[model samples]
Target: MQAVNISGFRPITTSVPRSAPYPSSARWRLPMKSSSDYGSCDFSCRQPLRISSSFSAAAAYTSADGETTLIQSSVGISDLLIVGPGVLGRIIADLWKKDYPGSQVAGQTLTTDHHDDLRQLGIHPISSGSNVEKFPNVIFCAPPSRSADYIADIRSAAACWSGEGSFLFTSSSAIYDCGENRPCDEDSPAIPLGRSRRTDVLLNAEGAVLEAGGCVLRLAGLYKFDRGAHTYWLSKGSDENRPDHLVNLIHYEDAASLSVAILKKNLRSRIFMGCDNHPLSRQEIMDYVNKSRKFDKTFDKFTGTDGPLGKKLDNSKTREEIGWEPKYKSFPFFLGVNTD
Candidate 1:
């Protein structure tokens, strides 16, 4: 077979074999195989037909101006294991299972606090000694709470990995808290988390993943579905007295979707900043929520400038590279606020 670009539906110049009796415009279906077996998997195509949801790889070629549509479709891994699967991790695992039914999903938690809850969600609890070979796709979602031991924890988990597929680590955008009141992207410089030591630990863990050819996603403040800090404050009627500091956020669902998108696209060894397109201020979000939800939250008559204005995030690289866009563009969309 001829080499084809499967990432996007771009036109390609290739000839079919003489033995194959098919027109140029015919749709050709290919079975899933390893990246070594096939030329390369296209991780950018959307709206693809569900050929075989099996963990084994599969691809489909639609004949239209020689466009090749090759979606990795679950990375061909039969199982996935999430380390320290908190809220975001659970969301990713659930979305992954929903998108690819054939894959087995499990989670590893240090404490038993969420074991029963995870089991109810159909995610089996796994330990460090669990066969990493069986679950080649591993995601590290542990936060910096244990900053002192984060590096060792990730390294230990990574050491157990069989190196069959991609490993993704969830990092926080606080790493970029350079105190700059401007917009930043993945290439921007970040201030050292001096004295705090938490940022250093997180950075160390990210470095380890990068060294291992894994992926690191720096996420913004997560909200929606009764889990936003802003929402908590709003419910308490506390938004009226706060300053309008800039804030970036990604809806829980969008974050989950993006994680699964990265995996299906076979992305690795890169840092992706996960945030929605809009960056609203505290007062703006509060006002919108109050007006839309009729919360009747009280605000202070005086606006106090206590801290530096927050930074905005640019997500153009993620959108262009992954061919994925957040279903919720901004907080307004999440809150169902009327744009008109």
Candidate 2:
């Protein structure tokens, strides 16, 4: 596997289980979906209708327009740990609570307030001491492209998993070299570029976690609440980067939902790419932005920074293997960009 980098709150909800028409990220934590019990299963092992109130392979879906929506079933972390309590980490922590009130998510950050935030979310804070004694199912929601030594940060966290339960490290799609105009699938080559050590840290981090019997999920570029790709363009008001740079994005909700799914399924030791299937061009997106937002989303052919971002990320692994199909296939609900 090559290395790429990628980059919640919890709220208490109903404890009652119900059966209804399955919308993609609908059921929270119902009960464990038993394949034999369900009597029928989807390609990815998802429980058929009336499967159970429990878990969703829930589906990790990527849209053609670049949206990542994860519909997961019920599962809780007896003790959940979220390392890197930054913006991304916070987002995950919030969503985790909404999906699985039963699970305990603890976020780790050098920041002092992170401890308080974790406490608020009912998550244990890992500021200094280790949870090795506790062995919480951990989720390292960190970006692979950030700090030069970011990989080391994750390694330090993995030191805690006692080779039990689930431990996931969030990675990126940048591991595949996107030269000009090419979309890379999970099976694509690890064509490295920029600061990514496709052969080193990115892969190393994934290997370390997996060696400990944990799972690795390679994520594509993400956008939500006016952040990341869409935000960048909104702020720029111009079409610069390859609008069609194979936009594979997951909504904030999908990421958290997928985590819930993994815990429910008790999965381990596999590589899954996180993204909506549809890849769009920057020009096409910018045009949409201008047409919809009534803002100047136009730009010259080239502007801002140009680094090696991967293209056309395949999220079929998530679907075929875990029965993941994201909701909000594109940033529509939030973007005012509709696709009917």
Candidate 3:
């Protein structure tokens, strides 16, 4: 086997016996035989059939014919590369470290501005021009803001992925064209390309990931304690606020957990929705914020009644598939309101 350059990252080459007639791609679920199995039993590939070097210590069995079969014992989050380790990416990295101690977590940033901060959190930072290593588990959390061509960026990230692991792209739920406050799901129709520039870029990028057999997570509005839509609304004071327009939201922690779940599952070419399953209007959100008195500032009253309504996202199927439940169930719940 020879080293292959994918985008700018080069996969470390390991020689495999040419006499073995293995298929181009295959996956196997092998039983663990030792304590060093990384707590996972699944292994898969997408490129030319070859086991990952990480599995060098995998178990092997010899048949009567003297043929030896190597079984990959585990495929866990041992080595991870997070593209654009911003707020969400950093959270994911923290959780990864907590769950899998001693695992290496590297983050890629566009500049050296926050490299020190990443280092403080025990994350190795890869600057823009630095050589990227091919990671078995990769999660792309970079927004499309700075990219001249977001689709191309996604392609480059996809290329840097090792075929033996999972690659996930964090996309936005804004791609869905369900603006009339209609209920939306993973199967909802996306805003057609060319109609909206933002959606077009995201949709194209998502297409690139799916074509490469990666998973796509369309996340709803992400909010934390101090930063989010409510914070922005309170700061800027929108005069044209549409009080009736619904908005779907998810806490940052929940979103990070969902990302981790999807990566661990290693699903391919699948789209998953992430939301709190609680759709609240602008007025409703503000009402809860005011009632809680958690913030020093409060949002002004929203007077406007007519505008384009956001989608009501129902991720019941996603919850069932991923076996995840949000810690902060809704905005009101987070604000200590008994919505039940």
The C-alpha lDDT values of all candidates are 0.61, 0.53, 0.70
Model 2: lowest-lDDT 10 consecutive positions: 20-29
lDDT of 1 by residue, 1-340 (tens): 2222223221111222222121111011222222222121121112223233255453443322233333233433546777878888889888878876766676776655576788787776654333222345678887867434666566655553435666778888777754545887766655443334565566666655654546778888999856786667666665444366778899888888887787666554567788996888877777677657645564333256575777888877876777789999988887788856
**Candidate 1, run of 10 with poorest lDDT:** 20-29
TM-score of 3: 0.78
Better of 1 and 2 by TM-score: 1
Report how far residue 26 has shifted in candidate 1, in Å.
40
For all predicted structures, in order, the TM-scores are: 0.72, 0.66, 0.78
RMSD values, in order shown: 15.3, 15.5, 13.2
- What's the ranking of the predictions by lDDT, best on top? 3, 1, 2
Q: Which residue runs does candidate 3 get wrong by more than 4 Å?
A: 1-77
Q: After superposition, how far is residue 285 of candidate 3 from its true place, in Å?
A: 0.3
Error of 3 at 339 (Å): 3.3
Regions of model 1 farther than 4 Å from truth: 1-76, 128-134, 146-148, 177-180, 193-195, 239-242, 294-303
- lDDT per residue for candidate 2 within 257-313, as digits (tens), equals 665566556555556677777666666555556557555444334353665544666
